[model samples]
Target: MNKHLIVVTAALLMAALAACPACLAQTAPKRSAPEERQEQKDARAARITERIELVIARFDNNKERHVAAYNAAKARLKEAITELAEKGYDVTRLTADLQAWDGMFVKFAQDYATLINLLRTAEQYAPYESQGQFAAAIQQARAQLVTVRQDALDIRHYYQTVIRPDLQALKDQNPSSSPASSGT
Candidate 1:
């Protein structure tokens, strides 16, 4: 009877290990596989966000740097909304305001990406190309910067005005929801 119990326990352990590949490792992981994976994802996101923020902070009074900063800001916006999008939440469908904001964000991203590419290509070809061409490219880049700045401002305003109110309302609805454990 004892031998039968031992064999049964060993079989269950093997099955558990097989089911969870991480359990097969020589050393036990501090977190379960899912938790570890989540942590890794969070770390990656943090790194990307930090990189974007660094670009923003280091932006100088130059067209190239400004374009880089705007591009980085676009990346930050994309990353900020990725989890919400991945969760299959239709934020744009929730309200007219949300839909407008979503459209603005998308348009801003597209414009920034195009502008960044144009600026980079111009810079690359500037030395081999004519001065007039380079100057015209700079003028084009500077002209686009105004709209890009406005897009960023609009995004910031939308987040502060619309999203915060909705979030506060949600928090108010849930009495037992603690801010510390919100995992936000």
Candidate 2:
């Protein structure tokens, strides 16, 4: 009888422990639908904030590379133009086109810098409470990026349409030795 009573007590204790979680769940305050929605919204905003920060970091890193590439290309073109001029080829049009391209490059760099600044501003306002400001900054940055894209395209178009053709014409005009070499 003693053994049976001990076994029954242990079983009752185990059952009570198993049911306590359900009892506590019923007593706990339930999250309303609105609260759940707000939580989801906050989680989404946090994810967007993280993405914006990542984009800003990447843009910052790419800025230096863009500047380096532009300088290298500009220098190469200038050197080529000087060499051609020394070889008695007329590079007047090439020189003008180069100047125009340089102006476009300057605008591109400026616009890119503006976009970076806007991105930084957006990062500053990425909190859910300041979503409106963050969105505005993102829009401004997007517009600036469009301007930068157009500037880059204009540079490429000018180089391909005007500069390259002029360069090819100069090469064709002086297929033989340089004037000095020809005189030798």
Candidate 3:
């Protein structure tokens, strides 16, 4: 009977020990100090660099698209002018349309440069984690860069959906559905 009781107690103790880790695991997780090391920061930066490169490549790939859109807009503008001339609409009225997006193309180009510079800066600063303040700054800049890129996409979408249709409408129902006017 004594041996049986001892065996039962040992079994129960072994089960309890096995269950303790599961119970503890239900709470906060343990993180080793290495997770907070410079290597981790560098790895994160590398991943961000890869993402940035892919995004840049995609953006470049869309260059033809962007130029095509611009060309279409210009062609429509010319058509609108020709229609107005035929209809005897004053030439100066077209100035409103021309000035609508004035300076925006240059601004957009500058914005791309700014984003590229910001990404390069982040890549450079990413591994320099010795200074906590600098590391925090790098993180903040990266976050802001994400916002900037998102804002750029939003602007592009707005142009495609809202502005392009309006320009096409100004062409007096002349649909912009051909790649013949692609090169700008």
Top candidate by lDDT: 2
In order, the Cα lDDT scores of the candidates are 0.57, 0.78, 0.60
- Model 1: lowest-lDDT 10 consecutive positions: 175-184
Model 1 root mean square deviation, Cα atoms: 26.6
Candidate 1 lands at a TM-score of 0.38
List TM-scores for all candidates, in order: 0.38, 0.70, 0.48
Candidate 2 lDDT, tens digit per residue, 1-184?
9999999999999999999999999999999999998899788877887887798788767767777877898888888778776677666777777788788888888888888888778877745567488778888989998887787778778888988888788756754355322111
Order the candidate numbers by TM-score, best to worst.
2, 3, 1
What is the C-alpha lDDT profile of model 1 across 7-104, one tens digit per residue?
A: 99999998887878664565664678988877786676456446544544443334355456645754554443444434443333224444566677
By lDDT, the better pick of 1 and 2 is 2
- Evaluated against the true structure, the overall lDDT of model 2 is 0.78
Candidate 3 C-alpha error for residue 156, in Å: 7.6
What residue pairs are clashing in model 1?
none
Ranking by lDDT: 2, 3, 1
